[model samples]
Target: MAIGYQSLFNDNDSVDKANTHKIYDVIIVGSGVSGSFMAKELVDAGLDVLLLEAGEFFSRTNFPKKEIDANSKLYWSGGIEFNKSADLAFLRPKVVGGGSIVNQALLDRFDDMALDSFKEQSGVSFFTKESMQPWYEKAESEIHQEVIPKEHRNKNAEIFAKGFEENNYLYDSLTRAQKNCAYEEGNDCIECLSGCRRDSKQSTLITTLKSAINNGLHMKSLFEVKNIVHKTDEVRVDGIHLKREYESFRAKKLVLASGAMGNSKLLLNSGFKKSLPALGQNFYSHPQFMVLGLFKEQINSGNGPFQALKSADPNFRRKGFKLENVFAPPVGISMLLPGHGEEHQQLMKKISHMACIEVAIRDTNPGSIKTNRHGKMIIDKKLNEEDKKRKNAGIEAINNIFSSQGAQRIIEGNLPIGLHLMGGLGIGERARFSVVTPDFHLHGYKNIFAADSSIFPNAPGINPSLTIMALTKMAASKVFR
Candidate 1:
């Protein structure tokens, strides 16, 4: 009998001494969007590749079904990490598929405004639409995408559209990376946020990762990298296996695909900041806030497709914010709403009559990432004055929409969430300001590379999953060519 897909993962017992001693062509530090696609490209070129992840690998059948279980199992810091200030919460995924596993599956390309800002900031000529079109096309070809039909729009989606129309704001349907959602069977998309049980979502674990494995790529899970030793010709990675045993591996070249926090923490912990002074600077997160509207009739926002529309207003885009129709599980909603005891219970009782809209801001200020003496990652991020102005503008627009729709009460979420994490190891022409070069290699090191959201010079004010895939595809082509 043939082994299942989960058997491809190498645990402590499955990893032999000979495999650890052998030097490979390339070793990637993450198995998320960037690393998985990069592995597929390089493996197709007949190169030996090893991909490592710090989380456990789960098959479709074994994925967490409940909201609390999924949040605790699939994310870092139990699905919510706080900065020193504790005003903002960061949801960073620590699984094999990374953010793609838990995100809303929104797929969007960067517009001219976003690309122009990036090109101007990083001095990269290829940021233009014409230059990046081929790469984006290649990335899109690897996955299936679809737009939610008008007939399937839920009450929440209808409310969003009506509010936008009544307020004269432009909106559009969202394009998602999915296969067969099976809406005819009355399946709820909110339930698939943790990990799609039906394998409908086109996450890297089901797309590029499967192809890479078939092309002879080696993958190890639950192996956390603790240190990196860069040699003249090879790179050695040392880490703990299952939190106790020591394991090390060597490769001719290494690529860091861990997100902004993971990459910054790893580099700072390994003492690379001495050589690369800007290692952890320029960190950014697209801060998002939830605004809820309570209605007299039952909206049942969580019943069907949870999200279907996004703000397409050029004015809103230029104003540094976008609105989205979204809903969460009961556990998440409870956390978002304020009050206690009977007050909280009353809100929970009206869950079926609530609709939500999220304001995602394009933050102007950048923060820094550092490590204390204990080697724990410290994230120093805050919304500057300009960011606050933009957020307030978005909130005002949402309030107008709710009032126009005759909302009984409008509630703004107290906590600000950081979902689109970017920067830290930004890429640029000058080494003084950036950690990575335009060609996606470290400034001082030639054998190490990175091309994930960590290298993004700034926020794009749009969904970044598709752009990440495109950038990594371009990186693979340029690095190998």
Candidate 2:
């Protein structure tokens, strides 16, 4: 199916709202972390910026404090977790702030190992911990990064750490992006599954998007960009053709930050995929597995950011870089409790004290995406032998960590949620092999650029948001000039 189907969702009823007067210098697709930062940076540099978001406007009030939005107004089928298969569930958030709004807000920096590993793969040489260190500090500072002391840690977490150290494993205080912190005793992260409140999460909603809006960056939520209209070899990205919005509009330059899935669909639909064959190839979804520990004491694992601590042993290596990690949430506590009767009831009562740790692995798995016969973007991801092996190793390491930490009993969680989606448009030397260059510009299209995770040379076995930010900033710095 043609990726241009986004046109079907456009809203053109308000022809009167069309801006016949001014032309924006740049049009940014998706208002997530990168898009918001990109728009703000462009506008701050005196460029007319327009940012578009496919989801609705998520304000402080409209958003729910519920554990999951499954029953909230923003609850959409696609927004909630869904697996291509009925027995599985894939986690992805659809809203104004993008994944940043729904994520655990683990604002970690680019470790040296991750940067180096990515460089050797597609010859993407510019990404470096030193180069991105400044951005990291800035990002972390903005997010209010803090290291949770042993004092604030909940009883369960503190005990878990001790068990690890007693077993000769070094586990330090886990840092997190939060305002009111307390995980020492395994204090539960109250709103993690939903989204952090108290504005302490430091998500893009409070940082990039907030700043962009404050700087006159025009934002249009619920606007999905469907096509890129080219006239006279000049690129004209029409605002997505929606069922209820603007019919068509123009922009000088287009920046796509709609994320791996969304950007891949838009590019393939716009016919850019024809020129660059690797448009949606080399897809990497960091296979993640969680190990939950059910304790007899009241842990209250449900309280804080879904994840506040992480394990960093068996460093992930590709070329010469070491992978970094934080903590996982207490998700499996429900199932791991002792029994089906009174035992289960008592465990549920003490669920607050339960905690979990995850081993998230960035694999070499290569997956492909295809537009379904119906024209909707369908992701067909398959894990090969290599991916399976890597996943197993990651699982082993995670299980070991949990055991060392004195987890009473452990069981692998349900389908591993693939959070880090990447590689539809990678940065390689060849156009046929790579859709975009290390610079994130389309191989043949000079005016069109993709600044999302689609440009990842390969998966770096860690959170992609920070890397996404660095790459987007790098692209905007060179392309916008």
Candidate 3:
């Protein structure tokens, strides 16, 4: 089971015209984490489900290890998309598995504090810890998560953990959604971000989507959905296929799981802008920046699990940011390396000895996602004064951590980048102020639901994949109930 892009389904490559005329029980847009799980749930309930993905499907065997090739094939905007402010850049997935396809696979469950903020902002009681615990368990089971063992810690993780232990900062082994890769047998996790060449990471591609496909799910890859309209009985979705031809789909129920930006852009282009006033509002990216530690000893950060260590202190989390061990491939690491010309080359030479960590800021300030006249997405986000102070605080914390580790020098990332994109079609009290109702139903539209991070009321600073999966599972259950 290599982490290639092989289509395991019978009709994964093209649209199945056999059922194009028949109204599907449910049409789920975006075959990523939420859509994949929702499709599984619906199909398991005996509902006919059709899953649409905007990206081309590649086989696992074709998963590229090169950063350039991977970014071109797996990421949106060729991995260089940014917000209107230009201060924040985003790396988002455009593949079938979405962020799960290229993320570090960290699988932390949302803490009570994070959920408390959501409940407070949205007045949604089900956000309570007790209420969502079962959903988390179910998602954990589906993804096959486990804490990275001590022996599997690479030199990069060792240096990161040493920094925490020496500074008396509580740190713990990270639990990730991954399968055993037998690292001792020469298998490495460096390629996980590029699609896990060993097939060890439990992305939706190998977990939920694969299971759904096996259970008779209909997936139409390379089908970019443009607009969706709610009519008298069923919903209509129009889009272009891979062949540059128009395609239309109809369903009794529709789910928008095409991420925060994707979902908002679609709704805006479909002429539902006024009806869903909050469609592209309330966007947050959990502003993140990296700190690299230059060690005298070879850390070989690129050879081991990309993110195997994380801060365990509740106080640190309360301060609006968390530190997690991180590593990047050659090309990515080179770009993050400071200096230019020969100076940059000198740092690139030390790539093997560099250990990195990212400080993910929990942004409370809201942003908006808009579409230009041509229908291209235009994300506008800014760090408020409070967010600025927090950014400085998080950076100082990272410096302290590296100082404790006896690093020769520290390099702060020149660019502030975020991978977690949330909000936009938030679930809350007001229809004019929020895009979806508390139950994830899009306002003014019957049987249309948003089952992704787009509906998140606020930013959850931690890795959001696990939380998204749990929330979608709960939403799917409610849909059928």
Candidate 4:
């Protein structure tokens, strides 16, 4: 059976071509964290599922090694999409495994503060720690997780820990979704950020999606859904294949697991805005800014684990920001590092001596996603005064950390990167404020559902990938049962 981009054009009888004619039990759009997990559950229950992805699929053997290649191939808008004002750049993944394939794999569950705020904003009863513990446990059991051993901590992590201690702040080791990272064998976690070639990151591609495929889940990559038509009994999905050929598929049920912007744009383009009034509002991205600390001695942050510690300070949490010890590839760092001409060249020369921390703000102001007259996505997101204050506080904390470690200079990144894209299709009891229901169904559609970050009601002020998986598990059990 042909399954990738090239398979869409095959003249001979292919599984994809044959499957298009028969209505599936469920057709899931976007093979990301939510889609992959949901497909696994449904397929395990013996359902005929078809998972369609707009991006290409890649195995460990074919994963891109170079930073530039991975950015262009694994991400949407070539690794940097901007809002209307262009102040914030969004790094949205467009691969089969979505953000899971490219992220650092930090797997922290939401705390009481996060869950409380979610319940307040969303009015969903299941956002509590008690109600969600079982689902979180279920999601955790599906993947391998480990805390980064202290012996594996690199100079960057040491600097972060020392700074936190000096400033009387709390910090903790990060739990990552991985198995055998082989750090003792001289393996660097920095290289896996683009897409894990060693299969240690435990992305959906290597976990849920692989299991789903074994359980009779069918996947077709490079098949973008341009429009969706809902009939009384079935939903019809139509789109372009590899941006060239037209194709359509029918299913009894439809699931949209695309990210915030993708889901909003698709629904708007398909003319569902009339019925779904709150289709593209309340969007949040945990906007992050990197601050680089230059030291006289070499840090060699890229040589070992790229990230190992995260802010666990209650004061910082109350201040609505979190700090993380992080380092990026040269290509990504160059974009964040400020300057031009000889100044930029000198900074690049000192890359080995620089350590970095990022400030991730829990933005209070919500952005909105919309489609223009030409059907192009227009993202309007900005940092309000409260969000700006939170960012400044985080940056000040980072500067203090850098100074305590005898840093010569501190430079903040010129741009904010929106890594955790959420909301837009928020889940709430009322239709006026949300798109998806607490049960994970679309407002007026019986068989259409969404279970992803797009259904987030507000920013959780923490890593959201693990919660996305847990919520999908809850959704699958509630909706499919």
Model 1 misplacement above 4 A: 1-18
Predicted structure 4: lDDT: 0.89
Q: 1-481 in candidate 4: lDDT tens per residue?
A: 3343233222333224426689998999998999899999998888888888888787676778899999999998886899999999999899888888888999999999999999998899989999999999999999999999999999999999999999999999999998899998888988887778788999998889877876667777888899999998899999988899888999999999988888999999999989999999999999999999999999988877789999999999999999999998898888887889999999999999999999999999999999999999999998999999999999999999999999999989888999999988999999888899998999989889998999999999999999999999988875566
Which of 3 and 4 is the better model by lDDT? 4
lDDT of 3 at 453: 88
Candidate 2 lDDT over 68-155, as tens digits, reads 3422434235433433453223455556677777666655566676677677767766767777776665555545666765445555
Candidate with better lDDT, 2 vs 3: 3
Report how far off residue 270 is in candidate 2 (Å).
Answer: 2.0
Instruction: Give the true-structure RMSD of model 3.
Output: 2.2
What residue pairs clash in candidate 4, if any at all?
none
Off by over 4 Å in 4: 1-18
Clashing pairs in model 3, backbone N/Cα/C closer than 3 A = 4-59, 4-60, 4-61, 5-58, 5-59, 5-60, 6-59, 6-60
Looking at candidate 2, the ten consecutive residues that score lowest on lDDT are: 1-10
For candidate 1, lDDT tens digit of each residue in 1-481? 1122535443323322226878989988988889889989988988888888887676577778889989888898787998779998898888777888888889999999999999999988889999889999999999999998888899999999999999999999999998889888998888778888788888887888878877678878777888999998999999886789889999999999998888999999999999899888888889999999999999998876788999999999989999999998989999999999999999999999999999999988898899998899888989999999999999999998888888999999978999888999998998988898988989989889999989998888889888889999988865566
Off by over 4 Å in 2: 1-22, 70-76, 80-89, 134-142, 180-193, 232-234, 238-243, 315-350, 397-408
* lDDT of candidate 4 at residue 146, scale 0 to 100: 93
Q: TM per model?
A: 0.96, 0.83, 0.96, 0.97
Roughly what TM-score does model 2 have, to 2 decimal places?
Answer: 0.83
> lDDT ranking from best to worst?
4, 1, 3, 2
